[model samples]
Target: MLKGHDFLITVKAPGKLYIAGEYAVVETGFPAILVALNQFVTVTVKESGDYGSIYSQQYRENSLLWKREGNHMVFDNRDNPFHYILSAIKLTETYAQEIGKKMKCYHLRIDSDLDSPDGKKYGLGSSAAVTVATVKALCHFYNLPMTKSRLFKLAAIAHLDIQGNGSLGDIAASVYGGWIAYNSFDRNWLKKARHRYSLTALIDRKWPQLNVELLTPPKELSLLIGWTGSPASTSHLVDAVGLKKAEQVKNYQKFLHDSRACLKRMIKGFQTKSLATIKEEIRRNRKLLQSLGVLSDVQIETPLLHALCETAEKFGGASKTSGAGGGDCGIVLINDSSNTQALLANWKEVGIEPLDLHVHRVND
Candidate 1:
């Protein structure tokens, strides 16, 4: 049933950056904005004779041999670095079975441009991009049709099974590609649904409170990103906030309300193409995140991050840390492109490295 050794399929999924809504977006129905970047994780699948191999350019040491064991994948190495890829394979193959598609052995290779050449993470959601790429590659290999929504659900399921937290906005950005406004679905409902429904059945049903809308940013809007040269673990920061939520129940509620309001105004800015409204909300959101850090006793913004924001403010741009930031990138929104060169100069003077990334839009 092999197509031939020459048969090959490749798929690439773009990395994502959070534009707004960090800590609060983890809760169900909370809104956030994100953009897909041109940087991507690419997966290539080649038809194999009998056994299969999985390799990663970034994790060369973790390459291993695998074979099919009666509808299940059996790996030769236990301590492999391809957890997200393996999960994607298993889930997609399971869905393939439900659709009566035959499974075949193949050699899978992964390559990523999501990190620096020296292997430093830029907080660009590499894991999510890789997972999405794996699922997409397998779907193409199996001749399965994948709509954006279906791809998102399959990838989200695989990702949630592994890391088990966060808003999955990165996954959405990878699948949908471009500027998106996302509201997270109820994870508790999803946890229960997994027990009652098959993978195929679950993906077909609508997820509660989940929403993803493509946004068209104003033509005059100029977005600038500056990296602080330090990687922060999103899971760690989110976990810290989770632990403090019970103690600060009322404060958490207020933060959620304020975040929702702020996001609504920003979304309106996007709709009306009002750069001023967007900038004001960005500044407001920054203050809210600072307050959140104090309330949760977590250091969301590092000293370098503060400098990143202050420098942007001084250059006439509204800015804040992009993601769950103890350290990582900061984003600035400005209408005047003239200030960009000066801002980048000042950012470099203050130890911030300006990253040349732009919003990526996918062709349908």
Candidate 2:
């Protein structure tokens, strides 16, 4: 089964951009739509001597020597940048042991195209992508059968171990490429279930309310992305909103209801292949997020993001901040009849750099 002389195995997971339904998606059973971008985090595993090393191109201190102590990974240095990768390795290896697979030391290397040239994050869900890529690469190395569902569950478990908050929608998009309508599973349920069930039993069980459905965008619909050159911490923003959510319970409930209804209509737009309806709901979703920001006292839409949306509107494209959005990327939806060049020009004038990214399909 080992084809290469070096016994190398490589896997790449695509980064994701939220199309609609941001904050609300964090709640169990709430829905969000996202697309996997062409950019990716690639993980390569190769046979090593006795101990394994991890090298990442994105970090200044790139290499870390790790050895296995029973099931635990003992790192040479505690100052490490690979929390998500380490989590993935630990969880995947735990599952391997559950299924009677032999484990061996292997060198893992990571390369990412999800950030800017100078190592600035572009809000493309790099952590989720890297986690998925690491889990996928290790599964292959262990000769484990990895279905899409299994991959998503293992990756989600690994990511949630590090992140501790937010919907795992990014993991879904990374696992199942292209456009997807995702409903978050109940994290509370998983937290309790993990104590009751083993890793193998949990992977074999159905996660409550978690759903991932591939979506087909209308042929006439065109997507545009613009980077504001500022990266936001998703965990910090989510925590901020969570703190306010309890104080304004009525307002938070209203926001959730509105988001669910709006996303339903948008999903219908996709089902009917109506580009106009999809764009209309995108504008509506933007307004909802603005109200949410006002209620939560979080600046979800920065000035640069506001300018980005306004410029897109002037050019006949519906736009909004993509994710948690303290300052990151904004997404725009246009049609074949729209003026694409004018939009790019106006975006640049406002200091918004248009990114040349496309939807990445798994088969592609």
Candidate 3:
């Protein structure tokens, strides 16, 4: 199945978890803090004997052929589950042309463990991770000089082209590959940049407003991630909340102020390792999210998620639902590692699955 002198390239990207600043991050220029998890989505590309193809190990699919047609690449069928992959390929082809380069024909294989053994989605930002991996693989395969900013912008474009809405906090975590204090890029600035230069040129030029900084968690603090076994559609929840925010301008503005204050305290708390400060801020943040749910008539903080948070608080830890939070994962932060076992046992009793995740440090 292999040809002599065939080339192979592999690339991996970490999944992300939001620590704070959820709904507010999408407000043009707001920021969110997230940590890249240990779990990764990897993509591999190897020269094919015939036309180009793609295979997904996670999806357990056979190779699907693809070919270049004029200035674009077309797959065997357009109705596949992995539109993320297809979007990456097409976008990369366009990037290559914009930068005056040629793309080679190769077979791409994607693998991910963000899903459970029974195929339950963990709300780990799989689409962002997959897009990052695909872009990295294509850049590596073509020997493109890809930098972190370049990769992030390209992947963000590909993802935006499909989903049409997101704060891009997940993409920032994947590209930076660690705990980060991130502010969303200015939409107007990015629009101008897209019109002014190619992606390659944009990478070389500095916008100065794009804010991404790395942060190290203190040694005393530990995190526990628990899944609710139910998946939440982020788009649906965001839309519901967005519609309400438009109708309740005064309430939304007040919520934003409180959310920003909580996030500021949490960031400082991480630096100081002040358990009391962190716990209070997390509690306030949780309360705001609950209010958002009530205002939108959406279950942003479902009873199950609230129970998990309360249980963690009862055990002297602070917890809240991570991300959009109707039902995916809740993050628990504790000062002592000794509490981990007890927390896990209690979570098990309540049917919450504990995820084995940690901060992922990127290699320079």
* Best candidate according to lDDT: 2
lDDT of 3 by residue, 1-364 (tens): 1112347887788989888888988776566779899888888898765598888867665345576889888664322338778888877777777777766788888888877877667988888888888888887777677888888888887876666667888988988987798877666777777788876677667654567888777777788899999987676678778889888899888888888788888878777868678778878888988887777777887777888888898888888999999999999888865567887888889898889888888774
Instruction: State the number of backbone clashes in model 1.
Output: 0
Please report, as a residue range, the 10-residue window in candidate 3 with the lowest summed lDDT. Answer: 1-10
| Global lDDT of model 3 | 0.80
Which residue pairs does candidate 1 place in steric collision? none
Model 1: per-residue Cα lDDT over 172-252, one tens digit each: 999999999999999999999999999888988899999999999999998899899998878768888999999999999
Residue 191 of model 3 has an lDDT of 73
Query: How does candidate 2 score on lDDT?
Result: 0.91
Runs in model 3 deviating more than 4 A are 1-6, 60-81, 207-209
User: Which is better, 1 or 3, measured by lDDT?
Assistant: 1
- Alpha carbon lDDT at 259, candidate 3: 83
Model 2: per-residue lDDT, tens digit, 10-29?
88899999999999999999
The lDDT for every candidate, in the order shown, is 0.88, 0.91, 0.80
What lDDT score goes with residue 183 in model 3? Answer: 78
Q: How many residue pairs clash in each candidate?
A: 0, 0, 0
